[model samples]
Target: MFKDSKKKLSAPATDTLLANGTSFEGTIEAEANIRIDGHFQGDIRSTRTVVIGESAVVRSDIIARDVILAGKVFGSITTEGRLTITPTGELYGKVAVAALVISEGGVLDGTSQMIRTKDAEPSASTDDSDLETQSGTRKDRDTSQATLQSETG
Candidate 1:
């Protein structure tokens, strides 16, 4: 029905997927989630989450609400929510995110910036605690914050 189609269009896309082993070259935009596990060369913009799989190879700038990377990227990434890098993740460009978590063996060959919204304020739901990291050699740091950042080699 036309109502069903309209509902689908308004709902957030939870699966905008690009499988591994495939190669693509163009711009990608999504309203919610986008997962990529292939070779890509272009720009990516998402209003929600962006996930890059382990075997993926990307060359583009990305702007999203959140990002999870386990592959390799050669461009800048901006996220307002969080950016998490698994052990196999490797990035070679700049990043701007609200929260960043890099596990041991993950690589970040560029700089990072932490940003917070203007209306951001301390609240009961926000935990500002120090996190113990088993990764980078840096000393333990207090991570209790609305903005969290940890760097790894």
Candidate 2:
């Protein structure tokens, strides 16, 4: 059936799990989602999502499509999709994400850069993305406004 085929295509094949009391140190590269409940110290690169459990502690750079943090993290994070920090989550490093959600009790102590992938990388010379054009024009207008204000004042 077409619905069955679509469901199969959308489902991920595998997911990695790091249970409580476990510890890992090194770079982790996976194509599936990784859920960490223990301690991890190193770089993590995944095309899928990375979920840090409530008891987990991660101290490394994380790059993934999506990231859900319910624990403590102390390094840079880059997500192409969305980054969700739960109420119990604590983040102490810079974040680069297209979208981010922070719960009421979550704590973030670093800078956040909202990255528009289409703006940052155009497909072709003729490809005109609205975000890119808007951002460019906004930058130009800001610069011109600043110059005019300074000159007049």
TM-score of each: 0.69, 0.71
For model 1, the local distance difference test gives 0.83
Candidate 2 per-residue C-alpha lDDT over 43-152 given as tens digits, one digit per residue, 9 for 90 to 100: 99999989888999999899999888889999999999989888899999999999998978998999999998786776565555877898899999999999999999
Model 2, CA-based lDDT: 0.89
Alpha-carbon local distance difference test for all models:
0.83, 0.89
Best candidate, lDDT? 2
Off by over 4 Å in 1: 1-14, 119-153
Task: For model 1, state the Cα shift of residue 150 in Å.
Answer: 36
**Which run of 10 residues does model 1 get worst, by summed lDDT?**
5-14
How well is each residue in 1-153 modelled by candidate 1, as lDDT tens digits?
A: 345543211223448888988999999987869888899999999998888889999999999998888999999999988888888999999999889989889999999998886557555564434223433224333443323543431
Candidate 1 clashing pairs, residues 3+ apart or interchain: 128-144, 128-145, 129-144, 130-143
